[model samples]
Target: MGAAQDPNSPVVHLPAGRLRGATEGGVTVFRRVPYAAPPVGGLRWRPAQPRTGWSGTRDATADGPSAPQPYTEGGDPILGGHGSPPFDDDCLTLNLWTPSADDAGRPVLVWIHGGGFVSGSGSLPNYSGEAFARNGDLVVVSINYRIGPLGYLYFGADGAPGAEESGNFWLTDQVAALRWVHDHIAHFGGDPDRITVAGQSGGAVSIAALAGHPDAQGLFRRAILQSPPLGLHIPTPAEYLPRTGAYLRLAGARDVDGLRALSWPQLIEAAQGLFGETTRWGHWPTPFLPVRDGVTLHRHPARTLLYDAAADIDVMVGWTRDEATFGFALDEGYATATRDQVVERIAESFPDRAAEVYGAYEKERAGARPVDVLMDLISDELFRVPCVELAEARAELGRPVWAYEFDFPTPALQGRLAATHCLELPFVFGDFATWSHAPFLSGIDPEVRAGLGHAMHQAWIAFVRTGDPNHPDLPVWERYAAPSRTTLRFDAVTAAVEDPVGVSRRLHHRASP
Candidate 1:
């Protein structure tokens, strides 16, 4: 992609036809290229089909629409931006940034945005691929998959059209995107064999699951999972089937067609309650999760990865130092949390290991309040311990693995956020301007931004180019192992540390429901 082509021409000829791109900073940027047919009308719940070729040069200058999903309660994207971007059911497009059109065979990087499987699109400014393409001399691609009920709802009942194929249609959309890139990326000067899938939060969870899927094995060689909720349950048909009837009752739909006939607002209204309904394995009440359909996704993503399908690929897994601080301290949940409220929350979140979780966090935060201990407990149980376990599993399998702990505290909101969830996003993209109005990053200045941004950006670029994430900007990092659990702690003074979350790892045992 770095090799020089016709500088005046910003068009690439593909088998589908031709794509005209916009030039910015010496990189040709293409937005909203369809990887699959629109999932609307009769295709609402069907498996994604290949996007047909165009007859003429298609204009790929504008961003794509987001999938039909409900808005965040406050309309604030602490991870990306505020409010909802344009949305539609016919939203299945990808954005690409490449250095040039010539055959350079540069490594390809595919980014999957995180919104807890409910919101966020690939076209968000924070995931802008120009910086990655320009700096790394490569081609960067970010894709959009369906979210919300349309993405995760499981209706295992027969005669529900596509329900029998698989309930996790979002994962199907992801496979289609990778297949498109595998077949077509080389035409855009990217190497099909050098694909590296990188994602954060829910996107991380999706990528982790996709990495272990047998159907998705050869599409990508490596993966980067940032704060994946591995302990989060993947509901089977028995667990999710009843919710289908509840949805039907709420929407007044007698059957699948009746459900399809309803508008998005109606669909979202009926499904909204499911988001907060606590399941037996739910720690955060995320009911609209990837379903474990025996045909496609047979087991929990972590279990499938660790024990079976993850033998071939290499991965990097990590979490923020104070993941729950994003909610506890930033939203004033800490100040108002009652003793009983804290206890109930902890018990509900970790029913079986309540005592063990409490003791571990109490030792970790000595002299801290019960609420404070609860905050770290939720953080480790959902993210820290699960992340460590994932790396440890890869180490046990003798596959290459790298682990990290993002410890850079945001000085925003009067310095309350201490390395909270989604804080490291800007650094990875090297674009603080895109997140200019983000509340989590409000007070972090440009100088502090540049140092960390350069380090992470370089490290990710190196990971794409090579399998390893090590570069000169950070310390000498080693692969995560059992006894020492070597990890790279990224901060103002970044260094490699051993057994950073050793206490929590010992106390916690992840059992997927």
Candidate 2:
């Protein structure tokens, strides 16, 4: 360890202007660096515009406002609430942490936070990038883009001026951020050529979507997707416009102009009302998400991969062992579900193959609780299967891709979380203590924490620097292919396993028709 500069003060220059940053633990961090102009007034629902130049040094040391969102915290034990970041329309800012400001060409990792494409910010404490700057000697970047109605709702078809062409504003915002990095990151000691864009959950979904964008080519050479919900069906506008109309009606708005006139809080309430009406449908209830509008997004990432889209880029993807436990840890009904109840719900979700789906899980985990079986089913349907499906698609295309499963169960919440969604964040970022306050990850064993953290962090660094995750200490992580279906299982001791838990996955395929 070494002495560091005062975290309250440091400065760097950018194409737009000079920025004041903060330094701590030998890593200097620049916060809230605007990558695009504020999407406000006439700019609302439009593609992100270029940031205006600043005259003098701009103070970027403080956290900027988060995009407007309805609150989602439900006071659950395992699921903490997050729609609470300071909100403002000017939320297209990015944060960065570098070991030094000199042009050392350190590998850069840009992070996109996950909040179901509705609520999340780059400035969350759990997303701190100091550890990467300090230990991996990499420049870490996180960004905020438009979200919720302002980011995803499609109203332009109804002749609303900015609504028609605004279906993919969020995706455009991401492209703008990447372009900013390519043009300016070198001045902050990062190698723009070696950038790797990474994210978990919805953010990972966004990365997958970006792979289909023509403009996103060459923005990054590598990608890392953690627990992307690949099977979540995205509804077309015709299928979803009723809810948009409901939101407008809820807000008592005659049109986009009237909708825009409402305050942020009012807009959030209207969106929340629509979510309550639609959440029962089991599709993603958020009003904002990527659309299949042939322009910004050409096709679904899985379909894109089938056609070799982004085949030249290297990808590393994985999911935690029990990804759905976090969602139900706080739901008494789900936590106490009976075998019949589980079967009935699964039937409802996959009406075409309800019995076959239930039979597959019941047969795989005989004598296990119906609730437990259902949990595994939900996890596979939402994350694990998608992880394998994406990897398989990439492998079939002859693209370089590696897949893994994070199996380190948490010691918190009486060990009930069981390696649930987002449990791998601390290990991946190598910042357990910084996230000690997180409801889902608190109280982790120090010994298990350190070993897993070091391994995951190093693997990410190795992948970013050499385009391969293999190193002297890591187990031989083989490139994923269908014939062998070789996969890495990361736990207290990491190892490569052949088709770990393929029974349910195989059953899922058989049942899908």
Candidate 3:
């Protein structure tokens, strides 16, 4: 955590300035490197501006602040929030890792952290690029963007004040980060042309949007979307416009200047309040999504996704075996949840098909608790079905797409967590220290962790290295298609299955009205 200069550190020169990075554990790590100008003052609520070059070598040895976000006391059990990096408006920075800053022509991997578009930073320890660099021999980059109201709050049809491009600063910041990597990654031994964008949850949703985005399509050649809340769909500015007053009221701000004058903590407090005030459970995951602003983004990426513009881009999409099973951690009522409660939950998301959905779920999880049924139902609706739909959309265009499911249910809490929402992160990053606080890995077997971790890690590396995720370690993985719906299942025994969840996928068809 020290910011002192290390004489032996690697210094990579870029368009912005010279960046000195810390080398450790056989990888060079660059922390808190700015990709865009600080979104502050008049720039607040506006699209990200390009970073200006510095006069001298910029220190990239220490991690800076995370994007301004709401405070979750004691932190998130699954994601871990307490004792995390502090927040600031100058949060649009990125971290990079390279085996050596040479002309290796290595493929690059860029990560977008997921926090439901509300919280999360690329500087998170689990997102460290060391494993990718040391193991895969690839240049890795993880980036940050504005989040919550600061990044996503929308103005009316009149547009934002003091800036030309209106809302979706969140999405704009991402575009700028990808552009930064695409432009200057070569100085860090990364092949800009071979970049792959990877994200999970809200980050995954961002990748989907970036695919069709005019500004972001050419930034990366491949994409990996894990557990995106695609079923909820992206909201239009019209939908966002209604929520604007809540923030203004919270900050007592009539204009962008008045709002920006407030501290980040105050703004994030307002952001949390706005989301908590009226947003329902179904919309909770996307409380602050990048709006379908016709300017930067032409169409919604995951909801009824049609990526005709970026069809040629390779995609790898998947979810946890029990994606929604993690809902219990968020809400304890599921412990005593009843069939009535399950029906009510279904009605919120699908009112027209509540009875049909409930019946289908009941049949799927026969003799299971109502809470379990609700978890499975919400999991499919919120995460799995959308993942399938996204892959299906990519495949229908006659393009290459691979799919897989992470099924290593955590032995934590007597295995109540199961294979939950973010369980794959530790496995993917293969960093136990970063995930030390993670409740799911509290007492899990190291061997189990290492086995699945290596399998998933190699698969990701293979996908980034070559457009195909097929590696000899796993089975002959096939592209996801109709009927077979081949999906690689990650578990104690890594194997590829033909439509393993075919029954679950088909039951909805029978139940849909």
Candidate 4:
């Protein structure tokens, strides 16, 4: 039995089951497809196993359940509202959108949502694949993987029943999903050979981890890392063992069996309470992050990328102009800090180049408010600098790397927030009207803004299809290099810039991590 659909539906046969999706505006949309078995019960902290195949037709009309997360309200709502209802443990699923079921040679874009690895789902309306599917004629896939303790608990010598892994089980789930894509995307009109793994924030970090993994060597030929945090690579057990043990004990989990036996709500509460006031870091209530387990992740992502482990891969790396505005908005005082405090914090954060770097920003914008200065400094240190460093490192390896800076400030934020973190999502997804206050951001120039979306979306699709992003018809996107250090500036009118935020990069280079 199938849900009622338009007579012109696009039916595709997936390995798990046959699904029927509706065609809207020249694109086929399929939602809520499971890529792996549910990671619940005995499988909670284990590596994802292959999903058991289905025997009958399965409806792919809506989003699958999001991974378990704390219920809250009125903060950055990426996957539904902040107060949305809680979900279950079996949240390993994926959604797909394509131009046609017969267009088997089209490129594939797999998007990993960003919420510092805890919140956010692929089911957000802003992440819908319709526009990308219709405009670029490319296949888009978004997925949900385990998060928090369930996704990233670092197992120790306890070996409690299913506690077999040492690092990120969540990352393992991602690898499993990619493997599923390789095996089944062909049936849904996507070319397995032309896959691009792209993500932002924690998702970006995950992409970086995948890029470094030996198992992920040929899973995707290209990658796009947007705003990856410098500190997000899997940590060593030495760095997190105490915190992990404390969290386990707080959850009333005396052993692996006890931890597994704790209810999901009980686990979330224990993790939240353990994090205390520091939960602003966006998940990590416990010390649950990808650990440096020797097996899955051989080394840290940075070391792997720096050593040319992924040198052959094409990369597009970028950060926004005002990356830290969102962090400040989450807490107003963060933006209202004093100059001395800003410098002190910067020095603390980057002891290597604290004086030299802080001096440059302080001198350049001496009259600026403490919060504004802090904002720029934090943004660069956290996002911009790392992006540039990664690009520079990749360039040094003689790999083709393109760099970009998103400078368009969102109207919804008025002037308080510049092109802050995630502000470019609406433009990238071509859902500004649906996701943003269109009247404030676009005014009446819908057609003009619409053109940029077409161009940007096409550029991404081209990147996914061909390893290189330069389409002859589009603007010539030069590979990033030293000296000139050209970068594409995405805004109302996209153009190339010479060394976007060069001063900040220099300062960060001088500063230590």
Candidate 5:
């Protein structure tokens, strides 16, 4: 084999091909490296397969194509303030940021970007791995996977080929990417044994699923699930069975042969129109999502962890202070709801604990703005409660777990949105300068916030390197226990606090699904 050195830069050669990456701040970066063959055409709706090995060098310059995403008017502002342009099916790719081309066996941090599972790419500027790689002396990776109906629809009918095994194809894509990392990251100077998987929102949910997946065992050593929710977008077999039938009927075929006869675009359009305006979940169709497939996922991720399914893995999980504030921002009516409106919405969203939830928040938030109180209630029920429940469950199972609550308010949105959802991304990735409209990063002293990012980033690296997060010079984080739960409070001055949101967490724990 020829020397792996780029000669022109610091990129190296892999068994599959040669890659040339850009040099920034003394680190060499490679982007959009394919790990599996595109799951298009006949392979559509099937599990991911390994990419055919290539000869000579392949350029790892620009980001790979992003999977098909719905067109939002402004698109994802966080993805460089513009919507993702149209792209093709070849989107299974990964990006790498490293200090050197030679194999140094450095700890690896693989990031899974979060966009509610419907949207997001690993190529976002905020997810850039340069700072974390250079500052922590670690190898950083970001990956892209299938999304929406194409990646998540379930077909369990007997006549359809592979339908019984196709419930979690998107998750299978993630596991395949990890397998690629295990077999190939060494060539990029990363230690596969020390691989740590981290993600937010839907990506975080995927991490939790991987933790419980039997096939995913040993693929990753540690995981960080930020703002993970328990029952987001989970489809039941009944929900999918009818949808599968509809697709078959629309294609004008009696069996699996007829279903496969329809074109990809035709199938996608039929699936998109499955859920009409009168449907329970409004505009969002419920055809495709991770289900209780006995093979890929035995049960709900939270239940799996609670029953000791993930007892051997190390985990850090938590939520933000104002997680639901974003929902209010998207629709102002949510912030200014009346008492009757709040009660009705609560009952509709959470019928089991509607009265108890209303009482708890009513007592705690007396005289507060209706919007603020509603935001807290929804945020807790949807995200915060689910997160703490996972920690409590893991602790019960004798697994090591650490929790946190990001409380610092953002200065960019004025005081309207406190430490809201996705606020932690810029801080974690050290991209405050780019978010000029962000209040927290713009108004606060950069020097003070700089240390918070450094400390949090280092803690992640420490957890990935070893199961324990006892880095020198940082606070000794205690494992979450029953009554006296200790959590890392990330703010201007980060410290450990006992039971940060005790009452709300307890109420939600008792009431959550």
Candidate 6:
């Protein structure tokens, strides 16, 4: 239904119904507009269906519930505040902030939040769309998809109808949201043809997978992958079934209905063991993530992108300098780790390439302790090398691939947390003060924040408008090419460097698992 009449409220008629939104800072924003029907009851574990049309204007002024998720245990502060908006099963909603609803043909940027596919919704304060709409004159849309076991766990037995359709339901939800944008975003003044799907970490991984999926083709013209874990491919049914079985046994569910009947607390309890906090690196013992179930998703996204899949779409990919610092901050022991401890951890994590991994990082990071070297190894393996490889692969296909490295460190915690994972988000969104009170951004200098934030926010706008991220405010950034590997390093002093951190790239190429 529609809200009470007010001059400040703006109304846009979506395909489903009329949506009344609030006008703030010269932009009209509609919060929590459903893109799909609630994925509960019979819809649970199945693909998201179209949101049934309504008779009146639905109240779009309030925030919506997020997918069910367990509490975040990491020491990173930014991760803690994500679950605050609300949580519910009927959570496949999207928020839009537009300059006007007058067929402006403004570029659309659809954001997918990062929580390793288990947590995070689009309504986080950090994801507020007002800045983008106010500053860039574009339509900014952020969406929420399924998370946790309800979104990723496969329960259908071999050849079972439920199991086949149940897998990749989260990806299905995202696709449904994109389809909704294709059909209805024009009403919100966004160009349906010029949509850019961008995400960080797991969200970036989702974009990578979407790039490979044939069904997702033509929905978006360009993609921006920020710190995607390229090496973390989707699991095969065989690899994931045993974990699913264990979850069933833990929950005492004898059948699929019994599994779906489990409550949120019960489901989280059954799946809690999957995420062990003891590991120094980010390794989920049982991740409820996308699987290569031969239906929704087929092959590894990074590999598929290499062979001309989504090659027609322009791409921009990059990662932060100290990507593993978040993992280390989560485990304090790593800060004071002994040299032997470091070697042992490396051997345990990468048994086949322990020597090569050690030699490569140690040679480049001389005078550093084994612990520091180990951190570098994990960082490169987890993020740095994978991002570079993705760019190289796409560049090899002769597509426009822009590579970057975010080297700007925050002045938080006595400078311990360097340019780590998730740090670039505030700058990209132009909301540094929003995260100033968070644990991860305690000592951020105002001047540094403004300078870097301006560069990043403008660059993203440039990317959305035209398929290129280059803007006059920044350096002459070049598209990625073999050997040359031109990359824009965003820092206190942004520079266009040629193949920054080549040592780690070579090591990853030599010792990849």
Model 4 per-residue lDDT tens digits across residues 69-165: 7776544432225324547788898889988888567888999988766677887666788887777778889988988778877766553445684
Cα displacement (Å) at residue 377, model 1: 1.4
Q: Is candidate 2 or candidate 4 better by lDDT?
A: 2
* Clashes, model 4: 2
**Global local distance difference test of model 6:** 0.80
* Candidate 1: tens digits of C-alpha lDDT, residues 1-513: 421233454787888888878787779888889999998877777778888899877878788887877766555535434436577887889999999877989899999988777777887877888889999988999998988878877777573654555778898899999999998898888999999999998999888878767778789988999888876767878887777777677778877778788887788887776655544321444657788888668877776557545676778888999887765674454656665666666687667766666666777776866767766877887789888887887788788889999999888767666798889988898877777768788777677678888989899988889989999888888999978889999898788999999877766655422
User: Local distance difference test, per candidate?
Assistant: 0.80, 0.79, 0.80, 0.74, 0.72, 0.80
lDDT of 2 by residue, 1-513 (tens): 211244446778776778878777788888888999999887777788998989887877777898888665553465465545579888999999999988799999999888877777788777888988888899999998888888877664664644654377888999999999888899889998999999999899888888778888788989999888877766665655666677788888877888778777887788787777667522234555567666676566545544455778889989888888876754676667776777777876677887777777777666767677777887887788878877877787688999999998877788778888888887898887666657777776678778888889889888888889887778898999878888888898899998775875776673220
The reply for model 6, stretches above 4 Å from the true place, is 1-4, 72-80, 156-162, 277-286, 348-353, 510-513
Which residue ranges in model 2 land beyond 4 Å of their true spot?
Answer: 1-9, 72-76, 79-84, 159-162, 281-287, 349-353, 510-513
> What lDDT is reached at residue 505 by model 3?
68
lDDT of 3 by residue, 1-513 (tens): 443376777888887778888887889888889989998887888789988899888888888898887766767666556336488999999998999999988999999998877877888777888888999999999998988888888884564465444567888999999999998888989898999999998899888878877777678899898888877656677776667766788778886667878888788777767766656543344556677778866566673235466767888989998887665645775677778877888887667988787887788766877778777877887778767776766676677889999888887877788889888998888677877876777777888788888888888999999999887778899999877788999998888888866666665552211
Give model 6's TM-score versus the native structure: 0.94
The segments of candidate 3 whose C-alpha lies over 4 angstroms from its true place after superposition are 1-4, 159-165, 281-285, 303-305, 349-353, 510-513
Ranking by TM-score: 3, 6, 2, 1, 4, 5
RMSD (Cα, Å) for all candidates, in order, is: 3.4, 3.1, 2.4, 3.3, 3.9, 2.6
Task: Output the lDDT of residue 142, model 1.
Answer: 93
TM-score of 4: 0.90
